[model samples]
Target: MKTKVLGLCAASLLICAAPVATFAQPVAPTPPPHVRESIYVPVRDGTKLAVNIYRPAENGRAATGKRPVIFVFTPYRARYRETDGKVVEAALNDQLALASLIRAGYVVAVADIRGKGASFGHRRGFQDRTEARDGYDLVEWLARRPFSDGKVGMIGCSYLGGTTFHTASTAPPSLKAVFIGASDLDKYDFVRAGGITAQFNTRPDEPPSVDLASLPVDGDEEGTQLRAAVAEHAANTPMAPLWYGMPNRDSVSPLTGNAFWQEAGVYAYMDAIKRAGIATYFWGNLKDEPTGQTLFGATNLGSKFLAGPGSHCVPPQGFDFTGEVVRYFDHYLKGVDNGIDREPRATYWLEGSNGYVRSDQLPGVESRPLPWFLTGGKAGRQLGAAPGVAGTAAFTVDYKLPPAEYFGFWPQPMDKHGLSFTSRPVTAPMTLVGFPVAHLTVTSTSPDADLFVYLDQIDAKGKAEVISFGRLKLSHRKLAEAPYKNFGLPWHSGLTKDLLPLAPGEKAAVSMTLTPVSRIVPAGARLRFTIAGADPRQRNLKDIQITPPPRIGVLHGGRDPSRIELPLAR
Candidate 1:
């Protein structure tokens, strides 16, 4: 199941966390009847990308028929070995996925992206233009191979999945389709969500070190050499001491650093893919691990790091990830005439429910804006019906303290540091399918302050589950004109040119749209809108040294009524 969230992230952030889904069990299979070969495929720049091909074999010999190709591009070494000098098997190297396609009479080619594996080049990061071009070259090369038909299809998850879309953007003639499971579509926003860095970005999963001399020459020689080079690079460029390391981390391409917002630069070319009109499949989860991230999106990229329910480290048992890919490839590459393309471009998992909802657009439901007013008190407030009478509430925040000290789920924890508004218990089930928005009238004592809001569902038992979160550095409150808008969503470019400082002590209107969420607020459950000066609990929370003035005030129920609007599905 897939879900969606708002876009963009902070300048200095680190990202981490991967989620796993439960897979359905499959019958035991015989040894793979395929011929495996390790070869180097050259790109336009003369750099060779290490590739391992699996071609169907009949009776221990290569099959004679030409077949559609399934190409997978990955930075995570298409082939590698363990420290004990044992050659990693397909199951360990994602070869099991290829076996499924091979059995179905298709050829699978897994390539080590340039600079990562035996492929020669410098690593640029995810969706680099060079990588995209490399994909184009690889696809064309595969199409012309003796064992391949003219059609080529791509499939992968995460980095591999990113390459699928990047390659498709070039509109490779031989590239007929792309299937992305979970990938970083909105690269920049995901790394630094809402101008705050994601916590995962800080701790990256570095590859295991390999001994160049001890490597087995009989194994993938190029892969062995590549691992050795990577190890050497790591040794020479050891990470800086914890606090002095690069503030911003890039998962795909780690150049020294990039202009903060340009992380999603790869997406600038998505229009080409859309115009190419290739059959595309996107699989995302509404609830995945490492909170606030999303798995996939067709065009306007969806949320990047969402906190879903699954563990990314373990693959779900029983479910066949390959079966679904084969179905997609069969229809697009082999012309099997399946109704795959006729289906909606997206399939999202509805949170709080077991089944999925398909739609040509996100959210998949019609919704109306429901506004809740913030009324009463300097210490706390109730999220009741829009007040017919006006009221004002003031809360003080000590910005000098660590955000962790201020982090709290319930209203009481925020009693001295922040303020909140709560709704009455729901009498019926309500599903929120789009971005939740909050419009506030505020005055700050300092030039700037950050607003962190959490939209949570408190059950009849009082246990709280954070559904979605939103943040805005007060200076970045200015909204940009978006190319596309859904559910009256507000857009921010996060560009330096658009940033405006808050006028001290003057009332200013600020409107923020929290991340998109899809959940059924069960009966007898209450909806809570909690606000704080800082969010210490955010997965990517960083102590950016941003200390708002001693106090921040929120004015409500007058000409400028402070209220939050929830998008409830009708």
Candidate 2:
């Protein structure tokens, strides 16, 4: 009887295992999305702009449906050739973001601006007027395509983002919305911030390489068309002479006889963009180069913004904004009833705080002016609430001082290249969340000088992290009434007519507004403000080599009380 019972138990176990094995069979994986490459869309000038269309896939083929289009216009190549010879889309490295929108049944299109990639024509200048007209034509052309539903939205970061603004300013009937990231609204402010030309901005465009050549469009299998297009780029205007030669906002370029800054900037086309009524969403990083433009777009263009603490065109780690992009497009393009429209206009990541903050407008709360006077004493240079005894601090400009890594998330030691003023340890946590203005009373031995101011937060362990910085050329120190709302910050017109060179040994009051920032300083942390004459990062082409490095003196206390005013959260 025991043997019979054991045999029955074994039979029951086998019966149960049969169903489990059947259920564990391998499942098929989802197919990759589909893309139609090398299509040329003609603009008004009969120039064919090369574009790659990505469509939602069904059973490994493009789905049959009329879908709203997400367009990207970029000077950067629309497609790139990898080392392995595989062709891929290069919409400002926003493939993941585009992939999400494509999966949600939207057709995505990326086009090379007039002269770049496989497109036919020559680039006149950076974001020239012709490019803006081309964008208008492309939007209308895309709307008429068989796969499109007569509605379109623009999206990109950096140069690509700038194109979106330019295109939207044309007010294409089909263009419904735009999502911009890390793009400059003011051209002069970016290329020549504070009247000092940014060296990196004047560098020549990257020459094509074997491992990184532009990918040929679909029918150009022999790459004949691509080569001809590249040859046309030989006539492209060199950036160095175009940017460095200007020196001022109203300066005309001898090459084109055009006021490049006045025509190229989105700020110049603000009225047109406002008339277009294109829904705008600007993604900005506090640590990026265009922080000021980000704030300007938010406050002036009726744009919703998401400002993070990442560098350049990057978003904060582990923070995916793909959903937010889709949600925004969904509401405007598809007329979805998602609550994104009802959400706050601004969302920002406040560093050293509880993480992200949401509010109807940027900053979320009122800010009070908190002034810190520069003082020098036995304890070294200090930043105090009250003015110290009258005195002047002198330092010779170090032209040969090696350029430090200008911007990053890491901490760097404060070098002796500049004068540093440190504040006492904070007794209570303080949140600084706006632009900072540095009012400096200075005298220079030379006729003119450059001033660079840096603000850093030093922790208990003595690690100093730069928070915000600004620079100005002394000759461009004349102030002017801002054409638009300037958030109450001082505005330097940076025009040739506004030049004010300093006389030797004559004191001049200079006030410069640093880039916007949002950081929380905990108790025991100290703040440091450094003033220097030269930053190799922003070298002017004409002034690269000065005959003699000038000595600069900062007159503090007494009548000329040099101070830095910060916007502290109330």
Candidate 3:
């Protein structure tokens, strides 16, 4: 969590400092103060984006010469500070990393997207076309500025990381490179994994604030300027609040502007980015933990789940995060001839081994496919074996039951509300490095059912560790043939397509994708696959409300072999 400022001696080499914890008070060599200023940069539609520029300064004056600009566009009001020993709380002031970048002799510009902050415009949600174009305009403007060296790169985490993705999609000429870490690329996939609205998605939204006091303005001069800007904005025009999440499929409409429901509907515009071929440096966490504040950046291990070209690890451990950023920017923006790009395209952290595995391609392309068929037997014996006989497992959803009591963990009291299948203990190590898919035959008495599939690893002592899970609305189960995208993962055209409801007792094939994982199941470990009418764990969060069928059934064995596929790396 600590920021390590590295000096750029040569455009290509970084003089890195020892890694330090950001919030944990360490003796960090304070670099020269950076001169901070705010300006409004107008975009194509006459809308101005409020940008805060931080340039390296000495003796209260701008430093000599120009430097490549690291532009960060965020909607989450840039003012930020370390909250606990692990997290950062955001408000308005300036990007916490601005000083670090400036001290490193790089110009840093953090801008609020077109609709937020002191910027003038209707603030739309994430990845708005206008926001992306504003980035292109801001980059070109920064490149043309006297303090800029005509090379610009975008940097940040979470919201800013998302903006970087969209901006790259625009393929602006001045955007030379980008460094992104842990941002959700696909809005639909992230918001509605398994066709269920994520608890994080339902957060209440923050409205656009044009007031100068809304920003983290410091000192008399900056305060006076901010007041003047606020007055001018008011003299010319005016503004609104947004909801962060939707309860059901139909509740997503009212939040078209400045909200998650509308903003996250589209897929990540990676096609244009790939075509533009800008130097890209990206990484993500293998697992997304819904904790503390709402920072919507979770990488579905299945979506574009690659390793070496970039790297991903389980967060709060393993890597030196800030060091990685410095190394990447030094190579690309600083023109450092570091062998980063030449390194493996994918690197994954092995959970149990506490070591990293590198490969040229994720899933290795040549990796073996391990398929385990769903069989008819006892509830715990529902996985593996041949389809000798057909059987069905049923579960009921009771709306009267409180979310807490219904969805609480282990030796779960609600086991009667769902069905689980456990696999035999692995005699040796088993490594799965890619996406997992479930081919299920389902029948529900209700018109639709929200399906949640969980994968857990149980040790010899029977401690179950939830590894990954995926969901799909039975009605939104239809798949599209974007075969090239995400490879084997099932793609659902959510909200956009018709919701084909299921009839009473109608047996349908449900192709479900369990969230991708790259973990080692050690010896004597058992893999448990669980299916439920609703995911109680998420339901207990209060944000996620489940309105599933009274009862749902999973059919296994017989001619219609319901199976789950795992990608076993060599």
TM-score for candidate 3, residues paired by index = 0.77
Identify the runs in model 3 with alpha carbons over 4 angstroms from their true place.
Answer: 1-33, 58-61, 80-100, 207-271, 289-316, 376-380, 398-417, 495-498, 536-548
* Model 3 per-residue lDDT at 354: 49
Q: Across residues 531-568, which tens digit of lDDT does each residue of candidate 3 receive?
A: 77665545433333445445777787788877788767
- Which portions of model 1 miss their true places by more than 4 Å? 1-31, 82-99, 184-186, 200-224, 231-264, 288-296, 299-321, 344-346, 359-361, 378-380, 388-418, 484-488, 536-543, 547-550
TM-score of 1: 0.78
lDDT, candidates in the order shown:
0.60, 0.77, 0.58
Q: Output the better candidate (1/2) by lDDT.
A: 2
Sliding window of 10 residues with minimal summed lDDT for model 2: 13-22
Error at 142, model 3, angstroms: 1.0
Number of backbone collisions per candidate? 46, 1, 20
| Per-residue lDDT of candidate 1, residues 1-570 (tens digit) | 222222221111111112325554334345468887877667898876677788888999989988999888876666665666556534223323566777888888888776665565655444667778999999999999999988899877656767887888798989888876555555544544444543333444355443232222236545555564455334322221221232222322234354423434445566787677677766544433222223235445432121222333222232335566677789888888777656554444445544344445555236577888877755447787765357656666545334542223222233334777788898877767666789887777777777777777888998877676676767767776643323346655666567667776777678887766666677899988777776554433344544444366777776668888887765
**In order, what is each prediction's RMSD in angstroms?**
8.0, 11.9, 8.1
